[model samples]
Target: MKKRFVIWTAGIYILYVLVMGAYLFWWADFGVPEAYEGTGADPATFMTDRQLELSQDYSRYQSMLYFLGLPLEWIIYLGVLVFGVSRLFRDFGERVSRFTFINIPIYVLLLSTLTWVLTFPLDYARRTLSVNYGIGTQSFTGWMRDQLISFWIGTLIMAMLITVLYVLIRRFQKRWWLYAWMLMIPFMIFMMYIQPVVIDPLYNDFSRLSNPQLEEKILAMAEQADIPAERVYEVNMSEKTNAMNAYVNGIGSNLRIVLWDTTLNKLDESEVLFIMAHEIGHYVKNHLLWMLAGSIAVTFGGLYVGYRIFHVVINRWGNTWKVKGVTDVASLPALLLIFSLLSFIANPVELAVSRNAEKSADEYAIEMTQDREAAVGSFQQLTVTALSDVNPPALVKYLRYGHPTMMERITMLESYQQ
Candidate 1:
C-alpha cells in the first residue's frame, strides 16, 4: 500500500510539473490578443520594456513557487504519516492530557507547529521573491509577526474544526461528511460576518475615507448602486506592499467598501470610482451570495469524495501507520492529505467560476460608470502597481487566476462603448 501510494504521488507530481512547466517555458502567447490590436490596450503602449520584463519575471517566479509549494506541502503531510511522527505526537498529546478534547487540541498544536516549522523556508522564499520584485515592502520582522499571527489563527481554527469533525466521525461513522458539510454552512457565514469587523483589523488600521471629496464621490456612487453605504473605509496598505486593491466585504449590516490606501494614492479620482463601481457590481449582482452557495456545493462534493478515500486508505494502512481507527486524532494528517489533493483538483473549477463572476463585475462597472477610459486606466494602473502579467499563460489563467487577466480586462473595457 505504501509503495502504491508513493508511486501514485510521484506520477501526479510528475504530471503536474510536465503540464505547468510546458506552459511556463514553452508557451509564448504573452501578447495583446489580435482582437484588441490598435485599441491602445497593449501593455507595450504604457509600460516600459524594463517594466514588462520585470512583470513577466515576477509572474514566472511567483507561479513556479506556487507550483512547487503545493507538492512540498503534500509531502510534509505524507512524511508525518510515513515516519510515524503523527503517531508519536498523538501519543505525546495523550500523555499530556487525560481528557480527549484537551488531547485533540494539543495534538493539533503539535502537528501545526511542526508543519509551520517545515514550511517556513518556502514562506521565506516567497517573501524574498516578493520583496525583490518590489511587490512587498514589509520588513522581515513585520512579516514574521504576520506569519506567527496567521499560524496561531489557522491552528486555532483547525483545532476547532478537527475537534468537531472527529466527534461527527465517531457519532455517524459513515455519514459524518454530510453532517460536517451542514455545519460548515453556518460556520462559513459566521466567519464572513466577523472577518471584516474583527479579524481584518488585526492586520491593518481601517478608518473612514480620509479625503472628504473622494468620500463624497464614493458615497454618491454607492447610493447610485443602492449599496446603502454611507462611508468608504480605507486601510493603510502602503506600509506593506505597492499593490492596489478595493473590495466589498462582509454580509448584511457588516457589508462595507474597503479601499487600499495604495489604490487611493496610485489612481486618480475617476479610476478610483471605476474600481469602486466594479466592487458595487459584485454587490448589485449578488456575486458573494452566489459564490457562497457554490462553495457550499463544492465543499459537499469534496467532503463526500474525501470520505470515501479516507476509509479506503485508513482500512489499508491503519496498522502500518499505527492509527487506531478512522476517528483517531492521529489520522488528521491522512484526512488533510486527502482533502489537499481534492482541493488541488477542484481549484481550476473554482477559479473558472470566479473569473466568470469577475468578468460580470467588469461589465457592470462599465455599464454603470460609462467611463471606458477610467475602466481601462484602472486595469493598467493595477498591472503597473501589482507587477501583473497582463497576459498569463492559458493554463496559468485557468488554474491560478481568480479574475480575468489584466489584458483581458483592458480589452473588455476598451471595447465597451457608451
Candidate 2:
C-alpha cells in the first residue's frame, strides 16, 4: 500500500510540472504587454514615467490572476490535505476532511490579515521613528498617506502573484521548481532593465545633477577607473526621501551611474566622490554578474536537496506540507513553509558572500581614490542618514545584514588609513 501511494504521489507531481511548464512558457513569451518608453525628458522624469507604466501593467496582470485563482487553489489544497491525512489516521478521514475543508480558508485569511496589520506598525516605525531621530522630512499625514498607498498596492499585487504561483505549482508538481526557475530568468531580466526605469519614479521625483564641477569630477573618476564616463547621470532624489545613496548599474551602452539628491545634499563633494567610487568599484569588479550567477547556482542546489527531502518526509510519515501537485491552493502553504525554512538556513551563507563583495568594493574604493578620510566620512554619513543600527548583535549581523556594520566599516577604514 505504501509503495503504491508513493508512486501515485510521484506521478501526480510529474504531471503537475508538465502542465505548468507549458503555461509558464506561453505566458513568458507572449503574455507580457508592450514595453513603455517615456518621453526624452531629464533622467529623473524619464525614470518616474517609466516606473508608473510598469506599475500599472504589473497591477493589471495581478488583478486578473488574483480573482481567477482563489476558488481553484482552495479546491486543490483541500483535496490533497484530505488524501494525505487519510493515510495516517484512516478511521478519522471523514472528520479530518470536514474540519480541514472548512478551517483552511479561514486560517489563511486570518494569517494574511495579521501580516498586513503587523506591516502597519513597521511602516509607522520607519517613518515616525525616523522623524523623531531627525532623519526624515515627511509630515505625519504624508507618511500615513504613503503607507496606505504602499499597503494597498502591495496587497493587490502580492495577492495576484500568490494565486498565479499556486496555480503554476499545482500544475507542475515535483518538477515545478525547474520550470519556475526557467520562467524566472526572463522575469528577472525585465525587472533588472525596466524596474529602475519604470517603477522607482512613482514614489520619488528625479532631476538632473546641477553641479557642473562635481559632474566633471565624477566623469574624470570614471575615466580614470576605465569605466565608460558618459553613462554617469545625477538624479534629484531629495523631493521624496532623505536617504543618501549612489549606485552603478547596467553594462555597455545601458550602463549608468545614479546619485540620489539626498547624497548630493548631505555629503560634501569629497564624500560623494568616495561613495561613487565604491559603486564604480562594483562595476569594475563585475560584481553584479557574479552575484547573479552565484544566486542561480545556490538556488538550484537548494531546490535539489529540498526535492529529495520532501519526497522522503512524505513517504515516512504520510503527512507533508507538500499538497496536490503544483497549481493547487493547498500547495502554496506547503511550498511557503518549506521555502521559508530553507531560506532561513541559507541566510548565513548568502550574507557571507554579500559581505565579502561589499568588503571588496570598499577596498576598491580606497585603492582607486586614495582617500581614506573621504571614505570614513562617507561611511559615517551613510549610517547616520539611513538610521542603521551601529552596533547590531553578531548573530543578527550574520543573519540579517549584507554589509558589515557601520562601526566595523569605520574601524576598517581607520586601519587602512594607518
Model 1 steric clash pairs: none
lDDT of 1 by residue, 273-353 (tens): 999989999999999899889989999999999999999999998889999989998898999999999999999988988
lDDT accuracy of residue 20 in candidate 1: 70
Candidates in order, TM-scores: namely 0.95, 0.65
Q: Where is the poorest 10-residue window by lDDT in model 2? A: 36-45
Q: Scored by CA lDDT, what does every candidate get?
A: 0.89, 0.59
lDDT of 2 by residue, 1-418 (tens): 4466557656865666455444433343321112211211111222344443433333233322322332233333333354553222222332445443433433344334445564454456445545554457877776666666666656554555554544455566677567656666655555566545565555555445678888888888889878875745667655446678888876455566788888888899888988988898887888987877777777777666666665554454333533333333444444444555677688789998888888888888888888887887787666555544444444446756788766567667767853
What global local distance difference test value does model 2 have? Answer: 0.59
Predicted model with the maximum TM-score: 1
